[model samples]
Target: MAMAVQGSRHSDFFVEGEVYCDTCRAGFVTNVTTAIQGARVRLECRHYMSASGSVERSAEGTTDATGHYRMELVEVDNRGAELVCAVALLSSPVPECHEMEVGRDRAPVTLVQDVGLATMVRRANPLGFLQTMLARYADTDTRYVDTKMRHL
Candidate 1:
């Protein structure tokens, strides 16, 4: 006789992501990203048929020393509908990197039960901020005038 193993009925799902400071001002997060500590992030969810038509639920968390954050979400029951979820950057504790970068502020994730995974874990893309310092140009003493003569 073969015995069947049953999975736990109650489980928790999680959303994980990282926040970084774009030190190079490259407008994107690269391998050499500097992780920001104490950065605030938020997770929002919305149901399609809500009366107010706004976000149904929201949760917030802060980044650790490594600029990583994880937020726990209630296990979803995908009986016949879907829920839309998104993770967004709230604020950065670093004064210089506090401004949110456009197009890199939020990331969307889907939470469904029929994915065949024992545990649900979603990862959002790295969000970043632009550099605060302005560009500098060097002054040169050498100067040239435009010559009127043209060679044929």
Candidate 2:
């Protein structure tokens, strides 16, 4: 879920990241976690060029068989402007692992090149999804029900 934002030679930007399922329900990737193929991811950005107005940009991508996706933003000139971007989970192919992690669902990224980065690549923190929570009812019949609405 780590997003790597790269600036190409033509000023086009690339938003790259991987999607994974938290099999251990730990809210983070573990050794036994598996990649989520066909998962959807989105990149949203807002550029504040001046105090008068701002511009919004967005792009979507789907994860491949290896759970990797790269979205392209063409002709994005964010230099000398305040750019705020974030990558978020859109959907998961696995039904059991469709629960979005509370705080790790969206990852903030820096797209500007004024941060003293040695290269044109800027990396953001990891984002992930957790397995659906299940709970057994207190009644005699033992059946697990989805606890999606229940705050953990």
Candidate 3:
């Protein structure tokens, strides 16, 4: 099933990154990597707090093999933020698992290479959101960004 991307294509601005095991700092490498699959990878961009309490969220998603996943950030004015990108392995195909949080400064970023942890989260899309925005911004007729494309 094709998901409706506001633009003709999803871009590099779409964030995503890698995942690693705490004990083994390698890619979730090996055949028995079941524990790392289906993990929740989240990235939150908190600006300097709005007058209201609406702290902005940059993106969020889950991880697949190659130990990778992606998330899209939806914002108007691009001001960087303190980002918290995290991964949590859930339910016992393994056993008691806790969440791990990796914080870093984020601009219009696409990838977060491996930090010290076993896994990492990066901007999933290779083209990024702005590329899609351009399609909308350059619209000769209709606005495309918010337009919903059919899947079937």
Question: Candidate 3 lDDT, tens digit per residue, 32-71?
Answer: 3223445555554444455553546544566676456666
> Which parts of model 3 are misplaced by more than 4 Å?
1-12, 24-35, 49-54, 80-152
Candidate that would win on lDDT: 1
lDDT for each residue of candidate 1 in 1-152, tens digit (9 for 90 to 100): 12322234334568899889887667787775699999999988888667776876677989999999998876456621456778998988888777677688889876776666665787888888665543111122222111211211
67-101: candidate 2 lDDT, tens digit per residue: 78888777667452467788889999788778886
Model 1 CA RMSD to the hidden true structure, in angstroms: 8.4
Q: Pull out the clashing pairs in model 1.
A: none
Q: What C-alpha lDDT does candidate 3 achieve relative to the native structure?
A: 0.38
Better of 1 and 3 by lDDT: 1
The true-versus-predicted C-alpha distance at residue 20 of model 1, in Å, is 0.4
**lDDT, residue 58, candidate 3:** 43
lDDT of 1 at 86: 82
Question: Which prediction has more favorable TM-score, 1 or 2?
Answer: 1
Candidate 3 residue 76 Cα shift, in angstroms, is: 4.5
Model 2, which residues run further than 4 Å from truth?
1-8, 48-55, 79-81, 134-152
User: What local lDDT does model 3 show for residue 17?
Assistant: 58
